[model samples]
Target chain A: MMNTKSLYQEVILDHNRKPRNYGVLDHPSHHAVGHNPLCGDRLDIALNLENGQINNIAFQGESCAICKASASMMTAAVKGKTRSDAETLIQEFREMAMGERDLNHPHHLGHLTVFSGIRDLPTRVKCAILPWHTLHAALNALSSVSTEADNDPVQNAASHPEALNRQANS
Target chain B: MVSANATLAKVTPRINTILDTDKIRADFPILDIKVGNKPLVYLDNAASSQMPQQVIDRLVRYQTAQHANINRAVHYLSEVATLEYEHARRRVQQFVNAQEDREIIFTSGTTDSINLVMHGYGRKFIEAGDEIILTTLEHHSNIVPWQMLAKEKGAVIRVVPINDAGELDIDAYEKLFNERTKFVSLIHVSNALGTINPVKQMIAYAHQQNVPVLIDGAQATPHMTVDVQDLDCDFYVFSAHKLCGPTGIGMLYGKAALLEAMQPYKGGGDMIASVTFEETTYADIPHKFEAGTPPIAAAIGFGAAIDYLCSVGMDQIAAYELDLLNYATEQINEIKGASIIGTAAHKTAVISFTLDGIHPHDIGTLLNEDGVAIRTGHHCAQPVMQRFNVPATSRASFAFYNNKTEVDALITGIRMVQKVFL
Candidate 1:
């Protein structure tokens, strides 16, 4: 059993109510769509990178609170960081969400560490990481021939049995 | 005074037709388990029903005592297993009131059954310029296969629209039929919305044009009485897992003539008559569709589930479930910022709703904390969700085992979710 209070922390509820960077970005350098077919959580993430650093980032679409807040905090965390630093932070966040890294010592995640509660609720791990996944796809679009945001990589992860069963049970 | 007694006589049977839900709950062991220190209030019956001890016992009995492949051997276990397997087929045949045992084709589940028909019938007869009519309430299982067939055969797909209350627009359905309309496939009940389509009338309408129809009864069988013969549908499909039986097993009931006319969906050991180097022949009706070694234990468990349902009586189960639905709907209606979707006049015990400010996934998660299990998603009926203009909805589907107390818990859970969001 997990503590519901920990899972739906006050920070999460506040961010969910008034999510930051919750709109589309115009003339974006990269964009990608993340979808959780199980719950129909769809988010379109757009990023503006200037000189190897994230100049601006925004997201749009409907999703659960965990997803929206993660997107909100992720935008605030990676706003001025280099693309490589942003990738490292996302990897760290993913590891924390999946219970792979020590959540008690989320040294560099800053406020993103609030999502560490996802380690206790396995079903929500995908929700917490969905924005990061879309961000990863957006970043990868920088080097790819096609700039169209393709989130098939994230869709495959969401459709995995472990994530699907968790969504089904919830 | 005499009139009052007559009214009492008329209503006494219904009032007295109480389901011993506590006893029924006892038969299902999972209901006893707690979720997060709270008693489990399972309301997701439309997704998959929990198995009863009788069905579990049947599976165990099959595995321990009658374990053998059917129709292949002459030994004692083989003979017993074959008889039991065939006996389960008959049980399903009788449960759906099919005309003959041969009309029942066992498949993996409802999806497999629909895919079988699409491959067997649609691929065989449906050609260019043909139109297949479907309703907006169909689950993806009923929709995607037809879409594939239409795309493959150059056939046109016509849709029947629905009203705001989630009732099928019968006028539009009747208007869609023409000389080009070759077939109709409609859901007997909307799994997401609980709208029970007028399938009998719809089938009759299709038959008037000499077009055949298939009925998706996945959500109907658990909550209502289904007479496939009475409905006169060309094909009917349902899953056992939705009726308190095991998964990986379901039945497809088609008219004998249609089944005989159609091609077999798969080719393998059991479905063949004689295999040669150059040519291979097919077996008879039910065996022709069943390609390989089927889920023997699950099939026997499905028979036990049917027996248990019969003992409870479908009418009594329907009545008790209606009571639960009504109570839950009324309680849910009282919640502020909560609106129920799909309010069809004719429906089963399903309520799909959305909170004003809360996403359905959040509602589902919060409800889980309170041990009230419900389904929240597009429910594999994205068209229906699109029609309702919601990405997803939280659905609380009732079964005969549920009581008013559980409905109250659901209402309380919804309020708690609202509190958290607000």
Candidate 2:
């Protein structure tokens, strides 16, 4: 008995129609790109950080309504949060996504809880996580001190994508 | 002793007209169902055609009455199974006008058939630096196998480009053929665009270079009568599901010489003469390729589908479908924002098009609201989409049972999409 209201809420459609921070960031502290090759979904995320906390964040890409709106919601949610607190929120989002965190537990999700209905549609989980996947990549990029001038094959190959995510929290 | 056109004209009148939809609809219980409380307008036939009652009945009949493994047992039911299975093979041979039943090897479906050739034939002859010519208008199934072969073997894939009418550029194709061109693998008809290639003449040309031509007849087999002898293609593959049969059954027809020359694609119980720890001698022709307990019921059901088609007649089906295609083109073209892609003169009833300013996803959603089904996105032909310079298009593919009423529904649905979006 899933209502269309929960699935296609006005707020969600509003964010989808007019996404926030929908473009690339230039020479930012952290930058990453995530692609959902199946549906041709892509997102480029950039972060401006100050003293181990997120100061400003932006994202831009072309994607389905769910993904585009999710990105808009995510950037709005994470702005001005400490890196550690943002990581906690990422966990909260993940828990909400997997249903490990109670979708009905009103306090845990905050304003980002519109995606509770998305958890029911497995195909849409990826769309909801588009921004998070890119954010993970951006977090990873932030912690790496390896320079482009080094041109180390192992370092370069290992530094991007998964390595970026691993370094974020570690 | 006549041109292909003349032969087509001569055979047109004698075409079998077996199925009238008003009666045929009763055979398929699914057609009677409702979507959003409206009649289901099933236009996704190219993706997979619906099965008729005879095929379903035959499958159930075999399982209940004569269920047994084939060519491996000596008991009564075994013999019955073996005879029926071989008889089905014979039917397929005649259906495709193949030279012999031995040339027909059953596989899981079209993808499996193509994989068999790519692994079996491509590994054998397509060595390093050799080339395989494929069309831009192929399904991912056709494109991937050759790409896999090319990557491993260091062979290159040469795509035959399409013209404005969505037909292959034959001039560019002629230029691609040379000594290093090991094979030309082409789709008999495009699943996405509905463009039918002239495989007969192309095969003739490729054969002159002593290069074998492999035709993917997955789309063609369902829409028209395919005579492998007439096409003179080195190999042809198509699935039964797209031709009113159940899934998990497909046929791979190759020239006897080519079949004999290529090694087996898979290895298991039925394909072997005797298996030793060291080595095994493979079984002969078709069985050599058919490695295990094949889709016995599905194969038999596919045979039944052939019987159904033969009764209805391919020429009559083709003629009737042409009428629908013309009608659909007329209707679809009338919409202001609607523009049909792949305007090739000769095409199946597949109409891929874009509505001005509206996302295909939106269009598909609105159509579904009206109980109409249509496919959206790249349709598994990304290269073709790249060629057309569009991200995706909404497609409505037709089959024998689809009629003018459905076309009207589609037009109305499209206009609704326009109204909602525009």
Candidate 3:
């Protein structure tokens, strides 16, 4: 009751209101889609990877303000950064969203600190972090296709063929 | 002769007395509890309504006293369970105003009910060129079964479009039904949009074309009176749990003649009369469809629910619910950047709305803090959400037990969401 309004800080609202990297960009390179089937949130992420650096990024489709703003911020943050660094930031951001780290007590995890409060509510956790997950999956898929790297999938889904089939379909 | 305490009671009066909000609140024991450090204001009735003590007690009573498999038994417990089980079927017949008791066949839920029809009827009658018509308002439950059936039988699936208000284009639906249209199946009430579709009209239109209709009443039965005979629908299906009955119990009411003609959906113990291994004959209309052991205890509980609904009367329930629906929609419309997806003039309490910028999942969580529970996301109507060009929607569905106070709480929840995101 102590003004939950503060959770929607100016930066967050600004990012939502007039999102940077908004609309679909021309001649996209790394294009991927994110689906939140539970709540029907779908987003398409596209960007140009100039050499190893994510140069120009853009997205299309619709979602809640947090997801759109988060996507916007993500695209802005990753532009001009190396793919390796972007990958690390995605990991760090995931940790912050899981409440392992607080924004006030963090280094190397700068502006992504805006999302640290999302972990307080378990259900909303997915909404707050869907864009980040999408980015990671898209980049991972991009990297997998680009370099044809086969990383070890630490978790085994051998018992569930239906789930594997679903992933395959997705 | 009027007493102050009785007047102040929250429980709805059995007699024709005006309902008091405070009194009505006391009847539901769970309403007084807290979730996330806030008093629970459950508005997720479209997903499932909270069970009343009467329905819960019947379940317990069945488990304790009459815990025996019904039908094909000669023991005392079996007699009692069989009496109760058949009584449940009679109750369901009365609930939907079906012509005969034998028309009701117990199933898992609405989804299973639709599958029963598709596999049984669709397999038998529909050919390669026949079509099954659905609308954008359909839940995935109503959509997938027909899709599967069409795929299996070499039939096609045609979709009816919806306008900006989330109302189905009935003209388009009528247009889709022609010589090739073998059957029409649709949601009587939209779980996501809350549009109380004109199933009676749909039925009449399909009938003119000699096309049988199967209406998914999962979202409809709780709020309105459904008379299969009056509606002239070929088949109707609903889940008992949505109407305060136990989960895993539902009824598929098929016109006896159609059910008799359709091939048995599943062939097994109860559904067979004689088996020669080469030429096996199916049982009667209902028994032919029921196969295996049905949820006897849950069916008994469902009977209790029917009794409870009758006590309150469907007409009165429908009137009060319409009041709540109008109030909720009116208040939500006042919130800027909040868009209601389904604007069908005739609707139930289901309100699917989206705040311009906030994710529905976030809205659901913030609303939870205020003790108002609503369903968020696509609500299993992902295709419908896609039609509206939105990712998801925060849905609040109401029941007869809900009132202005709960509706007020819902508004306050939305305002809080607005404050948080805006």
TM-score of chain A of each: 0.80, 0.77, 0.75
Q: TM-score winner among the candidates?
A: 1
Error of 1 at B376 (Å): 0.7
Q: Against the hidden reference, what TM-scores do the models get?
A: 0.93, 0.87, 0.84
Candidate 1 wrongly placed segments (more than 4 Å): A104-106, A143-170, B1-17
Order of candidates by DockQ, top first?
1, 3, 2
DockQ for the candidates, in order: 0.51, 0.15, 0.37
Error of 1 at A98 (Å): 0.8
Q: Which stretches of candidate 3 lie over 4 Å from their true place?
A: A1-6, A18-29, A47-61, A72-82, A95-114, A142-170, B1-24, B162-171, B275-279
Candidate 3 residues B313-334, lDDT tens each? 6766676677777788889999
Write the residue-wise lDDT of candidate 1 on A74-158 in tens digits. Answer: 8888888999999999899999889899866646897777777678777778988999998998898854222343543234334
What tens-digit string does per-residue lDDT give for candidate 2 at B331-396?
999999888989997898899998876657556655776788888778888988888887788899
lDDT of 1 at B389: 92
Where model 2 places Cα greater than 4 Å from the true spot, the runs are: A1-13, A84-103, A108-122, A140-170, B1-19, B36-38, B277-279, B419-422
Worst 10 residues of 1 chain A by lDDT: A161-170
Rank by TM-score, descending?
1, 2, 3
